[model samples]
Target: MDLHEISEKLQAGAAKAVAALVQQALDEGYPAQKILEEGLLDGMNVIGEKFKNNEIYVPEVLIAARAMNKGAEVLKPHLAAEGVKATGKVCIGTVQGDLHDIGKNLVKMMMEGKGLEVVDLGVDVAPSTYVQCAIEQNCSMICCSALLTTTMGVMADVVKAVEEAGIHDKVKIMIGGAPVTQHYCDQIGADFYAADATTAAEIAVDYCAKVANG
Candidate 1:
């Protein structure tokens, strides 16, 4: 099976085709990890780059993500049987008092595209919840999003909670959203800040790689 075909169809956002192709690849005896990395993730990397360059928009990213998800569903059991592991784990949520989730959802998709297991905590998540989930899930990263200035302060509280939990050295904190900036990230002592979802995924991948190597 030409995994490249699967990658191309996935990039074109053909969910059904991607799913069918993934099954065909498995039938052809391709490794599940190969299909996941070279087919689905390869396609999503292209979409993420296009999005970051402004060559594509949200709808395109969404469709491509859907395609990736479809392919992944077909490959999931095989991947598990093969003992394929995600690059890293992260728990993400919108801060307390913030109901906006579009940005948070995008980041989750983008992270998953990069082969990171993302645990989405949904909207209006409290600071303590972020810390609790990170500890419970054994996540390497905690990502917080806030679209409102009022809610942005909650991110700082999250950082404090992580510190209070004495897991500050084990888990990294990342903050982002419409109201967030690099300065704010610095002020709040977050380990990383991304202006967009694509960048967020990249940052996560890089950090996970470093941790794995060390």
Candidate 2:
């Protein structure tokens, strides 16, 4: 079957179909990286774009992401055997005092969709914890989500902690959530602010590429 058909199936959120097609592609001697990029990530990129355009909502995006995960699961062993590695690693969590995780979870899925390895720190994450994870994981970026205004201040603390850890130059910071703003991102000395999960993932992928190229 054509790889684009796999992409179409993935975009349609046919989890079983996508998993089967991914296995078929592997059995047909398609490179795991090619299948991941052309089939799974391609479908996710479309969903991300539609989400950014507001043509799709959370439920649809979630479904597409689920399909992508299913396909990825089937392709994982092949990918590892082929020595395929993620383009970058990122640590993500909701800031301290904020237990909201729906947005954080969505961002994680979108980042994974873009083929970035994600270290999910879960909710109620402290600034120190973020710094520690970035340092230990050698992450290229730290992403913070805060749905409450009170908890958004923790993002600034994260920036401070990264600077204090002496890795500010090496680690980029991205912030998001309902109360987050570009102005606030700048105020906290963050590298990027995304209005939504789709944009957040795109910005992260682009930033990682730029960092790698440089």
Candidate 3:
């Protein structure tokens, strides 16, 4: 299939078809980066939309994410062989006291598919934990997801802890999830609020690009 057709299949969550397109691009000497951007990222974006709309659940999303990651894996080694670096570096986690990660996982996949390197700190992450990861990774930004009303309160703590560490200004904070809203992000002093995974990746990438070029 052509690139657009392949991307359409990916949007429809066709894992096998995506994997095949990835292999095809590699065989034809197309740059791995191009395939990853046009094929994998584009496909996972579709899957993410399905997830946000409740049209698909975690299992299907995970499988689609796996397909996208599989494509990314193929390009990873080649990227390293050519010394290719990604556009952005981000640290992500589910806020403390919230065990839910389906949303966080979706954001992670979407970020990776968009060619950003991601460090996932996993679920139920404490405020200090998020702070520590940011310092250690020297990440460009922090993305926090909270699914429960109770845990969303901890996001402010995360912001404070990171600021205490003196990395708050160095990193832009973005917040999202089922229960998270723009007001919450503003209240917590986040740099941006993403309503869904696609917008998260887009905003994060564009924000960092502007930073990098500035």
User: Each model's TM-score, in the order given?
Assistant: 0.98, 0.98, 0.86
| Model 2: per-residue Cα lDDT over 1-214, one tens digit each | 7999888998889999999999999999999999999999999999888888889888988899899999999999989999999988999999999999999999998899899999999999999999999999999999999999888999999999999999999999999999999999988899899999999998999988888898
Q: Where does candidate 2 have its weakest 10-residue lDDT segment? A: 1-10
Q: Of the pair 1 and 3, which is ahead by lDDT?
A: 1
Q: Kindly report which residue stretches of model 1 are placed more than 4 angstroms away from their true locations once superposed.
A: none
What local lDDT does model 3 show for residue 38? 73
Q: What local lDDT score does residue 184 receive in model 3, on the 0 to 100 scale? A: 81
* Local distance difference test values of all predictions, in order: 0.94, 0.94, 0.80
> What residue runs in model 2 are displaced by over 4 Å at the alpha carbon?
none
Candidate 3 backbone collisions, by pair: none
lDDT order, best first, reads 1, 2, 3
Worst lDDT 10-window in candidate 3: 1-10
Q: Is candidate 1 or candidate 3 better by TM-score?
A: 1
